[model samples]
Target: MASSLHFLLLFSSLLYNFSIYQAKPFNPTDGLIFHVKKDVSTLQYVTEIHIGTPLLLSKLAVDLGGPFPWFNCAPSSSSRLVNKRSIQCLAAKPKTHQYQGSNKKCHIFTENRITQMAIQGDLVEDIMAINQVTDGSKTGSKSITTVDYNFQFSCAPMLLLNGLASGAKGMLGLGRTQMSLTSQISAQLSSKLQFIICLSSSNGVVLHENGHRSSNFRTKIPDSMIYTPLVNQVETPHEYVINLKSIKISGKKLSLGIEEGKIKLSTIVPYTTMESSIYATFTKAYEQTATSMNITRVSPVAPFGQCFSSRENDGTLVGPKVPAIDLVLQSEMVKWRIHGRNSMVQELLG
Candidate 1:
């Protein structure tokens, strides 16, 4: 009995020391994290990181921005917490082109601006042009005044949580609780740059509890859609207005945005709690977005149809089902120029 007591004392001391070490912050190169000790079934928090050169100082305007209303809107059978943090990030770029007779020559000139939810970090999402446009135009040329816009957003990947892993113990997490995004315009053309903005994210979560260790039970990257520009010639401002159309993920209709020199879309659909079942809504939303956000809703389709377990009569699926969610997106630009010194003029696309 005495020996057993001594061993128990030593084990308690080790656990105490381990808890102290866990209390310290974990700054991984990937992203920041929030660790909680208590057993919680649901947790929500928010953080924002910048998305540009670290030292480059410039103000951005949010032409339009909002939080992703839906995120992992379902419950888990294990000791895992629920999360519903919605976040949106947006950036804009401009392109210039000229039309010459039967032969139409085009050049795409662009500048990038980023905006996102306010969070407590200095981290910024880095962006680089997949396609460069330096050779499109020359400096100091008398070119027509038009701009081409590009947008970018990053959804930090899941942690592959230990709670969901084999021999699990506890769980920890961080989410985009709430956010607002906008675009900053140089003084001169701010007024004329009118904007009609919309922001959304078909955000969802994949939870692993219960040690259901199947390779299929992994977090999957959600489906995403964006406004793609087509080649066209423009002479007046009227010709610049491309008809506003819907952005579909998979095949479901998702939110969209429009402004001169810009187009934007949501990665996922918004959350509406008034509905009967969050899970059902999510399943349907995923399919629609996957179909490019334009399809009929299909629910109680798969796991629901099954007895939930091949062996147990508990009516629960042995494996978890995670759908491809919409990635968060934001779009903004001034509809009309705001009278001021167009600091944007100093922006060199050459």
Candidate 2:
């Protein structure tokens, strides 16, 4: 998550109105939300979405770079909502576009970029049960109410579910597309085209209708949120890419050539990875800083090249006491700092 995963989600076009059974109807402008959590074994963040009647809950893996969301399912209850204009053939591969269907009904072509497979799925529409929270704005007490929403999603076969969380029934598309999670909810439930995703949050995910900040949910750091312009490259409009000016260790800038770096955020990867040239310079600086701090270096591990004997050193609350690794973006004032917990991984050997 640290610096590897992107800080963005997707959007969709399919719209729907909200309804409640017994209580007064909720405002259409209120934010809609679903519960999301991180799977320890697979390291994939998943969210529970209530789909179909009788409220059948389905676990979907959250993908930041993924365009449209699709899941492995039989989808007997949901009806077909095939796109009349176009259909997605391959979700993520070398080439991407609508796979045209001549005579037969079009099956939406989508895939999980993380699993690296394409799925020709039938677009299905169903009544979705979404959680709506009262922020005590119009009402004094904070309470949660379940509202029904109708939306469209793609369904694939069970064979395509590979390299994904065993418990995950499907993938949640939170990327920049016409069929992304945010876009659909924003278009239908609320007029505002914005949604908040607390990836490391312990509190419940609630969409604010009046756009008021709540003490219950917040960022990891208090009063710390950096906003920068997102660069829209026509080449990869769906991919979340941010402009990184430079990398600094202990406030010292490293030589990463003249070209400005563009980092792509990922939902699949758990840790940050760099090219050999960048790794050489980055790790060398960190190792030197660790050496000065009297931290012991151990044998190499599988994925990580630099292993440290963390037992010898009492690290900070975050992790080991090492020099700060920062990603300077846009300007010197805007910096994404990577502390110990995120910078070093603690390993246990048998």
Candidate 3:
């Protein structure tokens, strides 16, 4: 009931917003800088087309924006060449403005897929955990002292994308699109991970969004940065900006202030499959069904921090700290197995 009410409120807000919007040529300056930061990282996942191959390789690229230098955090360059395995996916474009008490005048585009898999990884290391320490005065007087805490850690995994696609669109009688994907993993990867954070009283740590960790494998690093791809962009044509007002990780919490940042949104199409024919099929489907898939803005309220020393004498004023994130994307295969009893019964009846 609570979820239903939330959906109703959200739907009403969208309807009201849509009723007021008038499409016009986009101007970058016209865009409100609702959010700003030293840097922004855009991750792009491209789907390639391959024939005769039974597998799909997930390829991605990271684009840098702002004060920081380029960081090629995406997958290997060779990943771009591999054909993406196809699942049923499509881009949706609505044909009418039926819900706004208006005739068929406006359209909206969205992505759709029958299946997809996504993995995420995280890592954190060399951090200080401060604790309050109390000590007694030497003259038999009462006194309070403070102590510091330290911990070290790292964890990684492949994550699964389990989402049922159900969103409406405006295009003709094409209607809405519905599909979903799942993740699978091997038995070898189920082992428990030990997260350790090495701490010290002397060192100061800064936490911010632009920080990053080094690649574990030599092969994943490139000699030179590969430019952003020309095709299979994940950004959408629509200009929708989103700001993360709040975030919480573990037990820690933080709020996003105007000085903390602003957001400028652009829509995108994330390539998730690897078969040429399947790629074509899903792309066409997604385009056609853009009106119905439930593309949404999910603000993840994860814990993040910015800490530095006011005193240069202490190990403060250093750069931001990079924490690692990891998740396992279990492989899922579309299998068709015949039942022995049903097969035998059919044969006997024949």
Instruction: Please name the candidate that would achieve the greatest TM-score relative to the true structure.
Output: 2
Positional deviation of residue 274's Cα in model 3 after best superposition, in angstroms: 36
Number of the top lDDT candidate: 2
For residues 1-350, could you state the per-residue lDDT of candidate 2 as single tens digits?
12322432211112223334443466553445666666777777777877775567788888775676677654446555554444432222213345464733446667877668886777666677777754444554445577776666777888677778777778887767767766667667556556655555212242434343541233122566687666676876876787788898988898866457767766667667676677888888878877887877889997789988877677778567877888888898998787776676678779
- Candidate closer to the true structure by TM-score (higher is better), 1 or 2: 2
What is each predicted model's overall lDDT from 0 to 1?
0.20, 0.65, 0.18
For all predicted structures, in order, the TM-scores are 0.17, 0.82, 0.15
Cα error, residue 247 of model 3, in Å, equals 11
Residue-wise lDDT of candidate 3 within 51-118, one digit each (tens)? 11222222211111111001112232222111111121112222223334432222222222212322
Candidate 3's C-alpha runs over 4 A off are 1-53, 58-350
